[model samples]
Target: MKLLLDFLPLVLFFGAYKMYGIYVGTAVLMAATVAQMAIIYAIDKKLTTMHKATLALILIFGGLTLFLQDERFIKWKPTVLYTAMAVALAVALWVYRKNFLKMMLGSQLALPDPVWNRLTAAWVLYCLFMAAINGYVAAFFSTDAWANFKLWGYVFPLAFIVGQGIYVARHLSDEAPAEKTE
Candidate 1:
């Protein structure tokens, strides 16, 4: 459900881009992101961090899109948003001497801080790398190509992240026996 909530706005953006021009598509995406956020709030009775962060970016970029009447601003939206998140994660890791991803995802998976740091670094790097990739596509590729990447390219890394979590869990389990004996 959470994944669907995240994906729907991008889907709508692509659909709107197909059905209309970039301006209309950005408009539709702004509305769709709000609608999705509303639905998520109703389901959870509160906004998740992802929802808040996503909403912030959408509002900022949407306003820029509307105010400037330039689709290029909105086109750069994802790149900026993703880059910001990556920076935040990196800054949090440096300041706290801890991985923020572990704090965020700790309820679901319990692992050592060192392992969390590695995961966090990987996630941060991935986010930054994707930001660069998005920027490249937006600058050089067609809008349709960028939209396809936005929608379809998401699945691969998500699967890889899950696989990484599983690998970390297995490694932790192996260390558990040794720790118990000591």
Candidate 2:
């Protein structure tokens, strides 16, 4: 349910884009994101920092796209968001000596410090890679291509998440070790 809610805006934006155009798609994305936020608040009673950040970025970029009559702003939104996240993680891990990912998920996931550090590093790198790829697509390709990429490019995150899950699963202590035969 949460996953569907997360992708609702993007799906709507894709539909609106296919039906109308980029401008209409931007408007639809904004409205759908707002609706999603409202629904999430209604159900969860609180929004995470990620939700607020996504809302802010969408509103800002979508508004700019509409106001300027240019699709470039909206296209750059993902790159900007990914870059910001990478930067935040880098700062947290280096300057502050904090692992933001661990801080956020530590309560639910019990992993060694090394594993947490590795996971955080993986996320930071993944974010940077995502930002770079989005930027490349937005800059070198047509808006139509970029829009299509935006919709279909979800596979990247899905793959990353699966890989991360696999890595974490190996470290989970749910299974008992084999007994020695002696």
Candidate 3:
């Protein structure tokens, strides 16, 4: 359910691009993203920092794409987003000695400090890789090719998430069952 909501804007954008064109697709994406965020807010009662950042970037970049009549802004948005994420995580971890990933997910999962550090490092590297790949495709490829990659590139995140889950599963500490009270 949540996953579907997460992908809704992208799917709509891809479909709109396929049927119409990049400009129309960008409009559809902007509208769909706003709707998606609204639904998320309704369900969660608040938006995370990441969600707000995504919404802001979409509006800013999408608005630029439409206002300037240039597709480059939209094409480079993902690279910007990924690069920012990578930088934020890396700086927080290495410079500040803070594990932002653990701060975000620590309550949900019990893992050792070393495990959290590794997880944060993995996220930093993953974001960098994603940023580079998106930038490469957006810069060198045609609009159609980039659009195709946008739709197909979901594979990378899905695989990365599954692999992260597997790695975390091994380190997860088993909680003891609570005792029954009369």
lDDT values of the candidates? 0.80, 0.93, 0.94
lDDT of 3: 0.94
Q: Estimate the lDDT of model 2.
A: 0.93
Per-residue lDDT tens digits of candidate 2, residues 140-182? 9998899899999999999999999999999977645434388
| List of clashing residue pairs for candidate 3 | none
Query: Can you rank all candidates by lDDT, best first?
Result: 3, 2, 1
TM-score, cand. 1 vs. native:
0.85
lDDT, candidate 3, 1-182, per-residue tens = 99999999999999999999999999999999999999999998999889999999999999999999999999999999999999999999999999998888887888899999999899989999999999999999999999999999999999999999999999998973233489
lDDT of 1 by residue, 87-174 (tens): 8889989886767777677656657777888777887888888889889988998877877887788886788679886877675643
For model 1 the local lDDT of residue 2 reads 77
The best-first sequence of candidates by TM-score reads: 3, 2, 1
After superposing candidate 2 on the true structure, give the runs of residues whose Cα lies further than 4 Å from its correct spot. Answer: 175-182
Regions of candidate 1 where Cα sits further than 4 Å from its true position: 171-182
